[model samples]
Target: VYADNDPIVLVHAQTLLNSSAEGRTAYIRADVNEPDTILRSPGLIETLDLTKPVALSLNALMHFVTDAQDAHGIVRRLMGALPSGSALALSHCTPDFDPQTWQKVTDIYHRAGTPVRFRDKAAVADFFTGLDLIEPGIVVGHRWRPSAEDGGAAGEDGGAAGEDGGAAGEDGPAPSDADVSLWVGVGIKP
Candidate 1:
């Protein structure tokens, strides 16, 4: 399932429909703010199995939600609806290091009809509430379990980058300068 405030749902629905030949597909045009609109819709409730393990992704999207909407609260509500073993994968823009740049980015979004609320590392961690984080807890996107394909300074271990680049721990995969500003993590429900 996918949710977005924009009307691009039709485009994504069409793409999925065109790609899927053996499986069934459905699209619900709704905003994340009003999850009940999709949850309570006819056929949707009966179609998806809430008991099964599901991956809820919030990739580059949560920043659009402001504090008034209770972004973290909304995530908690969605996670609570799913049964145990459900996983949440999220990638959020962080302002932990460069506040000035982040502020400018936020301002740009403000002018473009959408408000961007970039959170720091700790603030982003708060969204995972009661879930168990997988290894390499809360690091830059590219630094999370990097593969050989990612060209960068490799450490003695298979992880990306090295101690000189700021990723120090055994599992710490040093991130490129640009990637050092973003925060990404995955958590599994118990």
Candidate 2:
């Protein structure tokens, strides 16, 4: 299901997905913390077949789901709603490489009323419990499945790739781990 707690985000997502020339698309303005809301949404019901596998993408989101909300339990509940063979593609902000920088960033976000809690790799791996991780499990975002140009190696800090279309920028070298602080992985329900 295509869901986001923010109505504006859902509007944009709906617009973008519905614009696709092929395939059916629907949107759900629901919170991830309430897995049943998303799983039972009429929009999702109309768009997807629960009897079949689904591809769930939780990109750049989990870090916002703080421990107070039981983020791991929320993920498990959501994923459990899907059938076997369902895929989960997730990306999360991490403090494993640069705890100081990420901590400052988290404070900034918290001040803005958007609290964030960066996790270590092992903590993020916990989200995929009961699911089989794909190749290059829980690596830096761009290193999950790099092209030949990325040196076919796992990323370390900002040296591997940047969020800006994988370009390191013209003025500086690749980013440091402190700068590019996100981990990504894909997994499948067995």
Name the candidate that leads on lDDT.
2
Per-residue accuracy of model 2 over 61-130 as CA lDDT, tens digit each: 8999999999899989989999999998889999887778788888899999997778998989998999
Backbone clash numbers for all candidates listed: 0, 5
Model 1: per-residue Cα lDDT over 29-108, one tens digit each: 77777767766765456556777988788888888888898899889888888889999999899877778888888898
> Candidate 2: where are CA atoms >4 Å away?
19-21, 151-173
For candidate 1, the per-residue lDDT at 166 reads 42
Query: lDDT score of model 1?
Result: 0.75
Report the Cα RMSD per candidate: 4.6, 3.9
**lDDT agreement with native, every candidate:** 0.75, 0.80
Return the lDDT, model 1, position 180: 64
Assess candidate 2 and give its TM-score to the true structure.
0.85
Best of the candidates, TM-score: 2
> Each model's TM-score, in the order given?
0.82, 0.85
lDDT of 2 at 74: 90
